[model samples]
Target: MDFFARSLAIAGLSVSLAACAGAPAQSRPAAVAQTAAAPPPMAPPGPCALRPSCDTPFPAPSKREFRHNRSGLLASALGPRHRGRDLFLLPGTPQWVLGKFAYGPADKDLKDEDIDVYLLRGCGAAWEKVGTYRTTEDEGSHPAVVGVADEGGQIFVNLAQVLPGGPLGVGRHRIKMVVAGDGTSVDLFLEVLPAGARIVVTDIDGTLTEKEEALVGDVLTGNHSQTHPGAVDVMRSLSGRGFFMFYLTARPHWLEPRTREWLRLRGFPPGIVHTSVTATGRMGGAAASFKSGELSLLKTATGLLPELAFGNMPSDVDAYWSSGIPRTFYYKLADDARGGVKHDDYRTLLPSLGELPAVCP
Candidate 1:
């Protein structure tokens, strides 16, 4: 099946919102006498009402070094000039490296130059180990080297094969370099990109909010609700960073008003909200199969290629993972590694979110 058809098949969009929310007895539409059907139930004002804490201070930028030899061979590798020239070993050089990692044969000869790299995480006065690498003499073939580099200079600290499972996640990673050798050192910052452009697809339910159970209950039973801790802040951060924030939910599209309001109220930056639509032309739940179909429609409409996806339920996680999003951020009330990677709660994971670079590649 085509990608769109696959997404719709998985989404099951035909589910009626009324059925999902358990329509109120008095409010139910009359089969025979009603002149006009009551307008779809108005969603509570401000679906997203919580705002992020603007007062929360951002961490200071961190500094590191990117030193390379005149021949360009890294010291970690067996070479005469492995240490490379200390590009910014002097007092006035820029204090960060901001570029992609460079690699070469174990014995290939190269130039010694200085470059600037940007640091993604590990900011503040303290120095955090964002990345590390060792050199081996395998010049016959291209040895995967991961580190920071720029127009002036480059530094290779780790082997590329150690990534995804190492400090840098699977796709791309940002790092800081500290030139350490002899009597002088310089700080360099760098951002590493994957082989291809990638995007992250995340969920709004349990993954970003503590009120997962409550939100699900309200969706399934038409109960009033409140925002959860850290939900607004996380969404804001993700939005500010330019991620395509998609508020994908099983809730019906008719809830758009309430959903938009809730986001504004809670300070979630305005984002594209996707929800279910009813088969009879209303909103909300139908059959699980129908809901899956609607999901497929939305996916086709957006044409978003998700590299990573975050969700709470096993089904959602499995669905996204199976669809080709490799990395998964699985959130749970309890910490357990059953179906995927789990977090204690969103807050515990907040620090890591900060680790992500503020700028997108």
Candidate 2:
């Protein structure tokens, strides 16, 4: 069998063993194609490359809030599994994020812009830094970038390697990032969930949130806020039932903090919110491609498929179907010819376990 087909069979075997959650997982010969490979390294850009005035033609920003805007860590839901066909899942498994340095306030720009990121553990005043990570230079692809001003100053930080285990233990963890130049800092939060038999995947816009009939501007701006009724309650119910929730959206990476904050403020259960990093993510097939790709990675990396998926757009249905979620389980907010389960809102959808077999292998 081909690699993907063999992996599916292995996943099926895992489902058959679901009744015996305590049984030892099966072991199999390692496939050469399953090995994890490090990403290719590129030459580090100069320190000030991310600033507007740092380079020719582009000028620094006049506003202060713009200094650190659109900067934070990416979230991870599933931890790395020690054994399985997905043992070596890389890009999506090991926690990583693009870190940006905050510049300017009193027109005093920083020269030494190295950043230090720490993983904070515990809640007391004695909170300790459990891990520290170094940043690798990379170009930012945010769609809102004007000219070439903010492209070069970004860096990628990997937290998985520095954590106690490859996967963080189940709990809430806060990441602290500090720019060595002006002492400016920011914090991002993430939670590692306990292993469960099924996962709940849903789209953000129009699926979980309510959209007005005639609002024409950007629907996913950082400040755009409106969610459907009972959306949070339904997700909370599913979370209580032991299904890991994943929010898949076509929004850009820069809006991650806003999206996360919206979900938190609205009482939704905590889960990783996946967004697009590319400048062209909303164009053409970008959204569908990204959602489908992430779903595929989730399955390939952890061998778990989403037991239930909720979406509104045709792209969502297409992506969920491509990711192997059943049409009956793929619920849509609107009735369409796509043939997935239809729901007016999340109020009536009670996610049930035991429907999806446990993922193994």
Best by lDDT: 2
lDDT of 1 by residue, 227-271 (tens): 556555555555455443555555433333344334445555544
Angstrom error at residue 200, model 1: 4.2
Q: Per-residue alpha-carbon lDDT of model 2 for 1-361, expressed as tens digits?
A: 0121223333333433441343221211110012122222323221211101110111121222222322221001111111001011223355544444322111122222355555544222333344333332333333322111234444444456665545454544555554543234444544443454456888776666665211112221113355677676666555655566688776634334445556665556656666665321352256678788778777765677787787766677778877778643333444353667776656566444323233421
RMSD of each: 22.8, 20.1
Record all residue pairs in model 2 with backbone atoms less than 3 Å apart, i.e. clashing: 14-360, 50-153, 53-60
